[model samples]
Target: MPTDLVLLNSRLLDPGTGGLLPQTALAAADGRIAALGDDRGIGALAGPGTTVVDLKGAVVVPGFTDGHLHPVSGAERTMGVDLSACKDLASVRAALDAARRSLRPGAWLRGWGLDPNAFGEQPVGFAAVGAVLDGVPAAIDLFDAHSMLASPRALELAGIDGPRRFAQASEIVCDADGRPTGLLLEDAACALVEAVAPVPTEGELLDRTAEVLRTMAAAGLTGGHAMDGMRLGFYAELEERGELALRFRIAPWCQPGADADAVAELVRLQGTGGALWQVAGVKLFMDGTIDNGTAWLERPDCHGESTHAFWPDPQRYTEVVGELHRAGVATATHAIGDAAVRHALDAVEKARTEGGREVRHRIEHIETVPDDTVARFARLGVTASMQPTHCCEFTRADHTDNWSRRLGEERASRAFRCRDLWEAGARVVIGSDWPIAPFPPLTVMAGARHRRPSDLSLPPHGPEQALTPLQALQAYTVNPAWTACEERQAGRLAVGFRADLTVLADNPLNVRDTELRDVPVRLTAVAGRVTHRAPDVS
Candidate 1:
């Protein structure tokens, strides 16, 4: 077959063996690898119409895949002010005040990546920043997407005067006198203010989403499992315009109140998508986030919170899982706490036993599971989809961070056990649950190896749980392919695999863990299409 693209003079790294392939060049035809050999042999496969480039000895590997992410929602939420760099209350106030200045009078103020720990010993309510946003209607999403701090004006605009009930474990947190405290836990409560906030037009949002996906490709991500499917149309439109850079497998949310009909609709959504994206599974929430005190923990946090599941009735979640499993639909549930992880595993076990079948069910964010639950992941064939930076950036080694302090010492010590899960025979896939954390694939991989912020000199959190360099690489490539049941066709550099590749300035396996994130992405390609090529690459 005539080759469509060819790379010559490249060092091919086989992630499976964590070594360099003897071949110095490869060719792609019709969106799959066609041949591999020395420079002269592979170069000969490229005909007149083919595009051939000399990699100049760059290192190529299977393109990185974020096993889990939220590109569309992340772009939407973060299109506003970014408070991720704010380290203290004063910095946060300064950022918000600056953002407030940019907005027209009476315009809504929106920000994301607000770290609760910035308050130090103070409570994480809008009151902490109410003075700065006194007149502005603001909705600041905490570092965890599960909660937001709504300014008093924003709450009043949403007509949320006091506490309100929700089907899920959501809360419009109230104070001592039964007045709303401006802390909204979970989606239902946050939506109250978000609905009233300003929104971009459909065109604007689609443009931003396309831009975000391109950024991911530039960051060396060829694909991602989008944990939310709300933006299927956005992806479709991008695909239609030939702007979609990443292959996305979307799993739309099946919330707490979903009935049989809703479950059926989700099943029907499967296989519905454009060329580069598909609704292949359903997303469910076993629990919210720990930072917001909404996670379903075996024991309560220091604040007596995180004691309930996201679903009002736990058995109903199991029933839904069984129904979906019977219909051959995979599910990825957000299980952040120990109790939530246990229940999700139980639900999958029950579903498999009752249906007498197997679907590659996944549990997202197994943040603080115990010893027993770690073994069940492999036993039940559940994939642990975790974001390492969550532990790296959110918590501290000394147990001084809010997440650590809330869980006390014991539960906190088990934070992000990526290594233990992998060693227990479980298939662990790593990702950057973007918008919550940064989405750089190298940054995510560096976190798995270091177990601490790459830029910091702090002691590692649970150093025993750090993954090896090769293990971290596989988590983003081979492991995600195994989780998606595409191992036979992708996640490797062999011929017949999809022509998805990333060319780095240096071999990731050969670089220091701390230096990994700095390795320049020379080129990124998906399905033989060059999605990103650094200017120096030829």
Candidate 2:
């Protein structure tokens, strides 16, 4: 059978073995690999209508998959002022001042990627940037996305005054005087301000989201396990319009108070998808984040916080997990603290032991787990979906960062145990929880190998926790496919597998950790359709 697309003059690399096959070309038809062999042999299989290209000896491997991310939410959050590059209070103020200047009359200023570290000695609050935000009604999200700093005016617009109670582990932070400080912790608290914040029109959001997905494709991500399914309609619209660039496996949220009906709805949502997108699982937060003092730490932090789980009733969470497991629904729970990780693991263990099913369940952000928790992942068959960049960009090696300071020395030392989990025989997958971290797959792979910041100037946070280059590659390629039960159909360059592949300027395994993040992506194809081709690539 004639192939629909052919690529010649390429090096076929196997992510699993760090090997290069003798074949220099491959062909794809009907969105899957049709043939692979020498350039002449595969080239001859191209049909008259086939699109053919010469790679000039570029390296090709199975396309990278972000083991976890929130694509639609990331796009929406980042559409406003970008404070990610701001390093200090002065820089943050300067950026907000600039955005304030450009604001239309009475327009609320919205921004995201505000780093809490920028506050230094001061606490994260509206007052930190209030000088520039007066009368602006601004709501800026901290980098974690679990928290937000709302200006007083924004608070008033949202009708918030003093502290409020939440069913989950969220808080509208109050000062010693019991007055709102503008620092909202966790989703429920942040939603108070977000409810009043301006939102883009549906068309506008759809267009911006499409652009972001293409940008992710350009970064060599052919697919992502989208941790949020709030925008399933948006994905469906894009898929119907042929604008969806990445394959998305969406998991909608199953909140703390989810009833039997909610659990059943999530099960029914299974297999709901379009050509390149689907509703496959459910997302639940076991806890919030350490930076905000909302994570369920086994012990209290320096501020006597983070001692509680997101769910008010902890056993209810276990029950929900078991219910989902019995119904054959896989779950990805957000568990950053040690207690949260242990509980999530326990829930999965219970679900597995009782239900005895082959569901592929996973836990996200195993941030500060102990040695015992690490071993349980493999034993319980739970995949560890970690965002390495969260360690690389957020925390510090000397324990000076807020995340480290809050946990103190011991708990902080166990940060992001990627290598520990992998060595313990657990299936570890890497990702960029985009908007929380950058979504570039190579940067994520590099962070897994180099725990230090991208500049490589700082000392490695947990040098022992660094993954080998090949292991990092497999985390993004092979492991993600296995977690999704698509290993047989994707995650490799074999014939008959999905033609989801990435063409890189250099072999990722051979590139230095510092250079890997910047490695040029020559081409990215999802299901045989080229979504991103460098202008330089012929």
lDDT of 1 by residue, 1-538 (tens): 8788999999999999999999999999998999999999998888998888899999999989998899889989988899998888999999999999999989998899999989999888877765888988999898888888888889889999998888779999898999888889999989899888989999999999989988999999999999998867888789889999999889999999898899999999999997678899899999988888999999999999999999999999999999999999999999999999999999999999899887999999999989999999899999999999989898999999999999999999899999999999999999999988999899999999998876766778988999999999999999999988899988999999999999999999989988999999999999999999999887
Clashing pairs in 2: none
Provide the lowest-lDDT 10-residue window in model 2: 126-135
- As a whole number from 0 to 100, the lDDT of residue 311 in candidate 1 is 94
List, residue by residue over 1-538, the lDDT tens digit for candidate 2: 7577799999999988999988999999999998889988887887788889899999999999998888888889998899998889999999999999998998988889988999998988877765787787988889999998898889999999898888888899989998898999988888988888879998999999999998999999899999998878998899888889999899999999999898898999999988888899899999999999989999999999999999999899999999999999989999999999999988988988999797889999988987888888888889999988889888998999999999999999999999989999999999999988888888888888989877777888898999999999999999999999889998899988999999998888899987898989999998889999999888
Overlapping backbone residue pairs in candidate 1 total 0
Global lDDT of each model? 0.92, 0.90
Query: How does candidate 1 fare on TM-score?
Result: 0.99
299 Cα displacement, candidate 2 (Å): 0.6
Error of 1 at 387 (Å): 0.9
**Which pairs in model 1 have colliding backbones?**
none
TM agreement with the true structure for every prediction: 0.99, 0.99
